[model samples]
Target: MNIRQYLDSTYLKRAIQAGITEKENIKIVQGFVREAIDEQFKLVMVRPEMVAMAKKMITDAKSQVDIGTVIDFPEGRSTVEIKLDEAFKAIQDGADDLDFVCNYEAFRNGQVDLVKEEILKCTLLGLKHHKVVKWIIEVAALNNQQIIQLSALIKNVVMTNFKEENYATVFVKSSTGFYKTENNLPNGATVPAIIMMLENASPLPIKAAGGVRTYEEAVEMIQLGVKRIGTSGAKAIADGAVSNSDY
Candidate 1:
């Protein structure tokens, strides 16, 4: 099967996060962009600062690899206004897909209205510009019930506020690939988590991000009905090897 098109090849680490110099980090991003161009992955997911660089590289190569960036990143604690500002900038910088980390903390605190408001506003901003939007619910940080509720919440917001034709463009994604769990637990997508999202976030697509490591795992996600898989090990998975990427 051609799994490449369903993959969002990713590299979201910063210099400090990756334990490298700033110049070295940039060099890695550059190579990542080029690899996406050559490999023709559906999109290249990067930090906001690298969106324009990825865009330029893909444009120069005349490749079809789309550019994606995260807003509010691993922490979904940022206010809606700040998330909007970050997303707006990413869009202007030529990102074709915007994955905003959902304010899962607020949801956990029972601030449903706040969560709904941000989902609606941020989603509208993305759809208005014809960009694909994915809400990262950070499954690692949420319980099973929270995952179902948040996924359904995002689906409700998209369904209630947007046109039917636009539903597919907005996804309820699984994780941010950056959440830390206690005691070396899996910090990303798991079967139960993806299933909860799939069942709850139906009409809106599902993008299983984080912790997916092998071709078999990717295929299993696909068979279980994930529309996309976001992983730093896109190449390794595509080549049928076990990926060593922490993300």
Candidate 2:
């Protein structure tokens, strides 16, 4: 299998998040972009602020790797208008895929209409711009039933409003790889969570993210019908090495 094709090489840490200076952080992002270009991965998933830089790097190298950026990031608590604004800017900055962290908190709080509206509106914006849209449900934040429900919610919104041909353009992604949990529970994609997503969000593809650190785990996700795997350890996975990064 061409593992590189399924990996979205990722680096989404901020300067403070990584405990580095701004200049040093950019240098790290530069190396990340260079590695993705050289490895010919499916995409480089970075923070929204890094989209323009990553776009330029790929353009200069003539690499086919696409640029993706997160919207509403680790916290899905932002209002829909705020999420849309963030996504619009990312799109204009040359992001090929927009992964929005769905407001799972609201859903958990029984604000179903709010969550549904954001999913529909944000997804429409992405489709209008011809970019792949993914809704990260943040599995670690919810129970199994919540995971299934949220995945189905995203699938329902897309299928109800978008054309069949565009179904593939929307994905139900697992996590942000940044959610903190009590007792150090797995805060990323786990097999059980992925199975629930796949079972509930059919036709619309799934992208397994968070906690997927090795090639075998990645392969398992693909075998279970995920369309993509987002990871900071794309190179390690491709090289058949186990990634020790907490992300």
Candidate 3:
């Protein structure tokens, strides 16, 4: 399969997250962007501050690689206004996609309305700007029932608020790749969790993030109906090997 088109070549680590100097981190993210351009990958998913850089790089290279950024990344605790502001700035900086972390903790705490409000507002921002919006559900942090319910909740919100022709602009993504788990389990999208997302959030698109680091694994995700695979391993996947990228 043409896996490159399905990969959002990702590098979301900050200087502290990867234990590198800020300069070094910028260089690494730049390298990732150039690689995405070279490989004709679908998108470059980076930290919000780097959206402009990705835009400039793709523009200078005369490439069509889309730029994407995360909102309330790794953790979904930001207020709705804060998330919207972040999304707006990224959009202004030429980002074509935005993935906002849904308040899974709020949902688990029975604050269902809070979760809905957060999703609704952030989604409206993306829709208004005509950017692709994906809700990161952080499946690793929830039980099976919660995953199913939350998936349904996101789908319901998208269907209720968006036009039928614009459903492609909305996505129910699997994880943030940073949520801590008991027993230190993988925090990204797993096969079972992805299957659950596909079954429960149908009609909405799926983007499987985290732990997808090889061509074979990415193929598996696409076969399971994921429209996008977010990974730091796009080059490795293009090379047909296991990626050592931690993000």
- TM-scores of the models, in the order given: 0.99, 0.99, 0.97
lDDT of 3 at 129: 85
State the lDDT of candidate 2 residue by residue for 128-236, as single tens digits: 9999999999999999889988899888888899999999989999999999999999999999999999999999999999899988988999999999999998999
Show model 1 residue runs off by greater than 4 Å: none
Q: Could you report the Cα RMSD, in angstroms, for every candidate shown?
A: 0.6, 0.7, 1.0
Candidate 1 lDDT, 172-212, residue by residue in tens:
99899888899989889999999999999989999999899
- Better candidate number, 2 or 3, judged by TM-score: 2
- Model 2: how far is 39 from its true place, Å? 0.4
Q: What is the lDDT of residue 165 in candidate 1?
A: 99
True lDDT of residue 197, candidate 2? 95
lDDT against the true structure, per candidate, is 0.94, 0.93, 0.91
Summarize candidate 3's per-residue lDDT along 1-247 as a digit string, tens digits. Answer: 7789999999898899889999999999899999999999999999999999889999999999999999998788888998999999999999999999998888999999999999899999998988999999998889999999999999998889888988888999998887777897888989999999999998999999998878888898999899999988888887899998765
Error of 1 at 197 (Å): 0.5
Minimum summed lDDT over a 10-residue window in model 1 is located at 31-40
